[model samples]
Target chain A: MAADISIGKAPHPLAVLPFYGTGAGFFAALAVLLFMTAGELTGHHFNPHVLAIVHTAALGWGTMVIFGAAYQLLPVICERDLYSVALAVVSYVLLTIGTILLVWSFWVFEVGALMITGGSLVVVAALLYTVNTCATAALHQNSSVQRAFIVSSALWLLITVIIGLLLAINLRVTFIPRNHLDMLKLHAHAGLVGWFLQLITGVSTKLVPMFLLGKSKREWLLYAALVLQNVGLVLFLADGYFNPITAKMLIYAGIVALGTAAWLVYLADAYRNRLRRKVELLMKHTAVSFACLAVGFVLLPMAYYFTDTRWVSLYGTFLFLGWITAIILGKTFKTLPFIVWSSHYRHLTGKVKVPLPKQLYSERLTVYQFYLYLAAFVLLVAGMIADYMPLIRVALVLWMMLAAVYAANVAKIIFHKPMITDGNRTQ
Target chain B: MEIELNSPFAAELVKAQTALMQVIDPELYVNIVDLGLVYGVDFTNEAKVKVTMTLSTPGCPMGDAITGGVKNALETVFPGREIEVNIVWEPRWNYHMITDEGKAQMGLE
Candidate 1:
């Protein structure tokens, strides 16, 4: 089959820009908060302040970018416009307010009305996003593997949020019979593997090949990944409820490992066949991300087997900051430049000499940012394992610098002024 | 597959196509003609040239940029001549419409 080069329209950049900007702001703030509270967070992941920090990073920074990118990407892949731009705006507003309120409530350890209201708003926001994505996907003429990945991932997002809300309510009501810690583990896994990883896998399968100018051949690998991931998630959730610290938990861990390995293999094949001989700096970060995913998967089972809080923290760090955050950073650098260039310089094509999409940003700055990010990530994992406050604080500083560099690069692209090479007027 | 070098219209067509190579679909990193976006070119008796084209998707946000690029390219080649660009959705563009050169460039060969 020939490659689908159809140029589908994207939602206006304005529709998605707020999410990226706000998410970056929250990420920068989280880095600072991490530095200030490094002493308090040492070996205590479940404290209210720590919870606030985690949620701010996960929901405000990570999921926020996913929401925005989805709106911009889904339409192009599906060959349809967004079903409801108005709904997307509403979702963004609700998500922003909800994330702020939830973080504040956790910071003050107020598990009362404030927490309930914030949690509810987030749930509603997730529901709205799900509706919008599903409606858009429904318009596609044929069923595709990409569609399966995206639609199922959206469903997982809904489930993850709903379970989260239940856990929040249970904290006050004492409705669940199981241990709160075990339930919390379930909630975290559901969000990380089911919602985040699943969605990332889906989007990357299509995008990686296009970026490399390579053909995507293996459909079965994607299907297998989808099946294994969902099955593993369901099993893990069951294990969390039934046997939180038993050998049976290994079943889910093994399944997740297989799924992750399958995805890695598929991606590796695509890269091997790529026509683009030179691997860009962004792709170098992506390769590191894959390695991080493998490390995290390996550590997950060991963490459970050892039953050590330090090991658990290390696993979370590798998965979240190393794998997910690295991929997001890499993709952001690649995607944002094209978006900015198309919005600004596309009109000048043929009429006047214009810069290529890749020329819109500074690659050197991006490379430096990636190095800082990797260093900080390593220090974070080491600090968590050793419970070293100073190391954690230093890592936080490095992370803040990385975020700042990223923001600066994005800013330059957005505000770029084209230098006209030809002095011809538009007829 | 070769243009008649003696015909003024054919010469203009070649010039227009060559200029159009500069108008790339940024996402695909390929020219619009190779991506099969351009469908027909006509030199009308009223001393005007008309180009018909379609985007990969109906909702393409780059519609204005592409149409503008087409006009700019034709105008540069055939100056002082009226240029008309008609964006039609009919006979939708597909990957199969890619020229042999385009196929080779895209590594499909």
Candidate 2:
């Protein structure tokens, strides 16, 4: 079957703007915080300050973008409008307020009323988003694997946030049965694998084909990935809590590795079948992210073996910076231009000459951003493993530069204006 | 410089085409005519302007939105003239159908 290119009625672009804006803000903040606190970060991954920084990057930057992108892409993916625009607005407001307060409370190492309040607000936001997306998915009668992945990922997101809230309260009331660090690991994995990775895989399955003008016949591969990833994540969490056995950990790692391998194969097949001969700049970055994911999966088992904090940090750096952040940076450039273009120039089309979506931003700047991001990602992993604070600081600087360039590009697209003329002008 | 309307049908057709330029393909961010969506326009005896067009895809969810856009554009241009916008699927649109001006705007040239 041909890929679904249904031009559905998306929610107002403004509904998703706050998320993109806040996500960018958090990314910048995380980069700056990392640069300033590099010295204090050595061998302190579990410190409250470090947790604050991680969450700033994870929730503020990563999850924020996912929420906004989901709202924009769901209608196109599912062939149905969003269930409720009002709920989307409410979710955005609550998430913004919640993220700010939670990040603040974490910075001060306060697990008191402030933390509780922030956590509660975030929980509510997650619930609202879950309900909206789930309801939208239910409207589509066909059982698409992509839809299943998306809905299940949303459920995982809810679970991740609920666990987070409990962890926050546990810090104060001491009600949790498991150790704090163990619970933290469970919470992190649930968000990373169950939520972010699953959603990315699902969305990419549809997008890779559409962007490449290719056909994907391997539906079974996608289903296998979904099953392996969720199952592996659950078992991994279980191993963290109850088993703590090396054999069980290895089994979980192997399952996740198989899922990653399947995903890589799917992408490779899509690329091979692509009709578009020239790989665009966005796809270039996407390829780099896939390489990062491959390397991270290889190191996963090793990271489990070595009980060193450095190895663990290296694993996380690869997972977050290499795979997640890289893909986001790449896909943002591809999607954002079209969105801003439609918003600004939809009414002016054919009446007068208008720039194409590609003309809205500088391609040269995007290339530079990709290189800087890749270099920073490598340096970060090396610095973490070696406990070299200076290298990490330099990496942080590079990351900030990447973020700034991206922000500037997006702003250019958002604020673009066309010159009016009687006739259309050729580029 | 103002030009004389040689014929009411000809003048109305020009005005209608100009109005249709205001209706855009929301996803492509280009007007339907430029996007090769408007196949043809016919003026009936009753002064009704009928537009035959197709979407980028058959399953396009913005079908209603673009159809509404066509009606509004025609009404604004010729207030008293009746308007009929018909969506057809024959002779599917391709990138080759884009006009030189549209191609230039899209950087396809």
Candidate 3:
């Protein structure tokens, strides 16, 4: 009968920072022609403009946003307060400055000393975040959901940074591998799929159902999916550097099995609880993202059948640009608006009349973006498969345009416009 | 409309229940109806309503948010209505307060 003291009374302002970062990251890519086209014109693969766009998107836009959400959600699910908000703020500052230094180093590749310093700062920031999550879990290990996500995410982050530092050292003083791109597949996958995608899905398993009025009953299936993924990733990284055919096959099989099983369970849950019969744009796009995941997973086994790396690249295209980014965009719509609404309007009740949360969005625009994304993803994947350069370029442009629209929608939510008349009547 | 003096109050109760369902705790992510919070709702007049509810646990952080949400939701349905939310800590909320539907949703037999 004792009350649970852990429930947060208000939506923290710090939590919404990540949403803003996501929106910013989505739009910033267009500014530098995403670092490649600009590079071609300027005859410099390493330019301040390109570095700014890349680092801004990667660290400023992606990692920071993820950090903000985790700081708020991890504590709640764990039924404990975070290790230190002050420490979190410190980590954020270090990461921000570190990213700036990194972009500068990219432009001046001769700055071996500077690269080492920036890389160390990034590692420290990751360490701080890792320590924060692990320390919080040490208290009241009640929520298994929180524990799994925090631990797994932290481990992957450590792996990501360690690999990153080694790469930097190689660039500076040839400390490890001779080939700069040798361990790249491992480094990229560890950070992308292992650290980012794994954490996102793990958290989604809990949040998606809680927000959307669904239930996740297949805990065992989730665990199975998780283990298979990690095993595959580790094995892939170990032997993939040498380009072993058997190792590649095992990795592809493992990824396919993991993605398919998770998708099935998620779709089944969503279908069962959609009795309200009101399918939001976010849900529609989320299903689209899962379809991309399924297709990408299915294509993995094809890599063994084919001898070309083209199939592998196509599979990567579907997984990264198609599945991972799509999910992030789709989920951000639901989560950002809610966070903004709660923080801004929760206290306005009883003082006077207030507009409903549903009034804050244009459902029409969101639905359009969802359909456009589906078309763009399909075109892009097909182009990649067919080796049609023109089609691939057009699809990327379309993807960028849709992403721009999504970014603008998120920006409006963050800025907090009066969506209805007489909005100020409620204090 | 058929005029029935004896049970004219039945329609008002249904209207009140519908309004209550719209109220929700933003943080807990559950509405008052499913939280087993609403104990009773009494209507003194067409423009006056009283709600009696308990929290999941004593000193729940969501106590104020849920109460505010209930008031807001009701006011929206029946504007300028006099609403009073009474927070009680008696027979403290447990599995018993959960209706069969709520139990099913929670997967509790």
> For every candidate, how close is chain A to the native chain A in TM-score?
0.93, 0.93, 0.81
lDDT tens per residue, model 3, A273-365: 633345567877667777777777677677547777667666655665566667766766665565566666665543344455544656666
Candidate 3: regions farther than 4 A off: A30-32, A35-62, A80-83, A100-111, A177-180, A235-256, A259-270, A273-275, A301-309, A417-427, B1-64, B67-109
Query: What is the per-residue lDDT of model 2 for residues A1-427, given as tens digits with 9 covering 90 to 100?
Result: 2223343554677767667777888888888877877776655478767777888878888888888888877776676777787898899888888888898899888888998898889899999999988998888777788888899899999999999999999999999887888788788888988888888988898787767645667878988998899889888887788854455677787897798788778888987876556787788888888888788877777777777766666677777778888888888866666666655555544344456667888899998988888888888877877787778888889989988988787777666665433344432
Local error of candidate 1 at residue A363 (angstroms): 2.4
> Which of 1 and 2 is ahead in DockQ?
1
lDDT of each: 0.78, 0.77, 0.63
- By lDDT, is 1 or 2 better? 1
Which scores greater on TM-score, model 1 or model 3?
A: 1
The best candidate in terms of DockQ: 1
For all the candidates, what are their Cα RMSDs to the real structure? Answer: 4.1, 5.5, 7.0
lDDT of 2 by residue, B27-93 (tens): 4556777878887777755678788777765434355567767887787777787878676656766
- Lowest lDDT sum, 10 consecutive residues, model 1 chain A, at A1-10
Q: What order do candidates take by DockQ, descending? A: 1, 3, 2
On a 0 to 100 scale, what is the lDDT of residue A93 in model 2? 88
Q: Residue A283 of candidate 3: its Cα lDDT?
A: 71
Candidate order by TM-score, decreasing, is: 1, 2, 3
lDDT by residue (A18-118, candidate 1, tens digit) is 77777778878778777877776545578887788888878898888889888877876666777888888888898999999989999998987888888
- List the lowest-lDDT window of 10 residues for candidate 2 chain B: B1-10
TM-score of each: 0.87, 0.84, 0.74
Scored against the true structure, residue A24 in model 2 reaches a CA lDDT of 80
Sorted on lDDT, best first, the list reads 1, 2, 3
